[model samples]
Target: PPATARPAPAPAARLAGIWQQLAAQNTEIADLTAIKNHFERVLAGRTWGDPVLLHGDLTLRNVLVQADGGVAVLDTDLALTGPAAYDLGFLDASLDFIDRWQVLSRGRLYDDAGLGLARMALRDGYDAGGAADDVALCRALRLLQRAAELGEHVQRTRPALARVLIPRLIHPYFLAAAARALGVG
Candidate 1:
């Protein structure tokens, strides 16, 4: 089996702080500027009601199925107090974009029916009618956050990759998908 790309999880609170800092200090990157402003607009006058401890990243790669028919969750670095829908949105988006990543594509779980079933199962497992609104918001937020993190990662470790990653894909995708979802565009 190929190794999973489970990047270190930074808490939602920390991410918010970083977003603020970036907005204040880093005005040179056009993508970051657009994303920050979009999120600011999308989140304006909105409040996350009662944040709870979330697994943060709940993709299939982070789950372990044991011989005893039990499951073990790994990669807790991104765990934090946030809307529970954050986890759900990440899982759902993982399904929607599974084909986008090499390792995830290997799982071959990108079917729409499968994704719908998985989301249904998730709602049932949580015994909630589904946090529809928060899920939508979190889905957009998570996408933007992931793109931002990837941009930072490439900038720090693989500076050359930034030229191809930032404006070309990450930034645009994040801005479009998130802004569209949030009706901010």
Candidate 2:
């Protein structure tokens, strides 16, 4: 074979892509105002086969490397009854974003960049142990969440991170998901 790849679309990739499709459709300014409510509603209604407690916003910064090589998590702000693996995906995405977005000139973390890194790290930790198969779906949903948040911050000016955070954390995350879901990548 010229190149070897599976003929079937990975379950995880398809899962990740759904959020990207949702994000692209919700590009309008209204999605932000309605997003948090949507997530809450969807989460409350849906249940997966492996449903378990989840940290809604698990990321690298939340996870602590223990002296004995164990991982610990903090920040239950995003916790819900959902996929634990998805939580790990968020962490992994955070790590990747941080590594890519760091600016030596400022010698400090930027808004989206730092947040991305935190997300990537969480996912990486999870995927590394085989969750990689389904990590894409979680990443996609993350971006959709970001787009919604951005819209809200745009009009209200509360989060104040609409441009910086959403672009860094949400856009690429969803795009990555889209690629996986559509098999463009």
Candidate 3:
């Protein structure tokens, strides 16, 4: 059977979905609510350009080590139109999980210091200085997305466990990350 792709929703709609998820699950605790408000504030503060193609899931796992000693990207099914820093910020967000980059690029790209340096280099190379706020917004969006997904799983699968995990663990982490993204941490 042939498959048809649905158009990706605008960024505001995507964020609204996250908010709806939080409301539906009654997971809008003070910390999470604050984070959400700050996230929205950050988004509102930024000036966005016309949406462009973005790798929605730009993680290390989606990067391929080509045979010719170059690099390639994979699993682009999630690609869609969004802010340019959506993908770039995703790389930054996923730095903690990117154990390696490749043969020649592998040493410490995942380390905190290394990631910071890499971010500066990328910003310089791309001359994307103005995209810093966009990157922060994207990072907050990523955290919210994760928290929303986890909230759904907990609500549907383990309500009791969620009571302990959501507030103490998941929500706190998301809030802290979002706060850092907003430069308020």
Listed per model in order, the count of residue pairs whose N, CA or C atoms clash below 3 Å is: 1, 33, 0
Error of 2 at 176 (Å): 6.4
- The residue-by-residue lDDT of candidate 3 on 1-185, one tens digit each, is 01333344655777899888867766756766667666667557556775555556877666544333344568978876656677777776666422234312646424444445555554553344344447766767777777788878887899878778877777677767767776764
In candidate 3, stretches whose alpha carbon ends up further than 4 angstroms from where it belongs are: 1-8, 65-70, 97-133
Compared with the true structure, model 2 gives a TM-score of 0.48
Question: Candidate 1 or 3, higher lDDT?
Answer: 3
Ranking by TM-score: 3, 1, 2
Single out the weakest 10-residue window by summed lDDT for candidate 3.
95-104
- C-alpha RMSD of each candidate structure in angstroms: 7.1, 12.1, 5.7
- Per-residue lDDT tens digits for candidate 1, residues 29-109, read 555556566666656666654445556678866655443434456897766655567777777666555324733455563
TM-score of 1: 0.64
lDDT of 2: 0.48
Worst window of 10 by summed lDDT in candidate 1: 1-10
lDDT of each: 0.59, 0.48, 0.64
| lDDT per residue as tens, model 2, 1-185 | 11222222232444345455435444433333344344444445454444445666665445555434455678865556545556654544454442345433266534554444544555555555444454544554555544444445553564566555555655455455434432343
Cα lDDT of candidate 3 equals 0.64
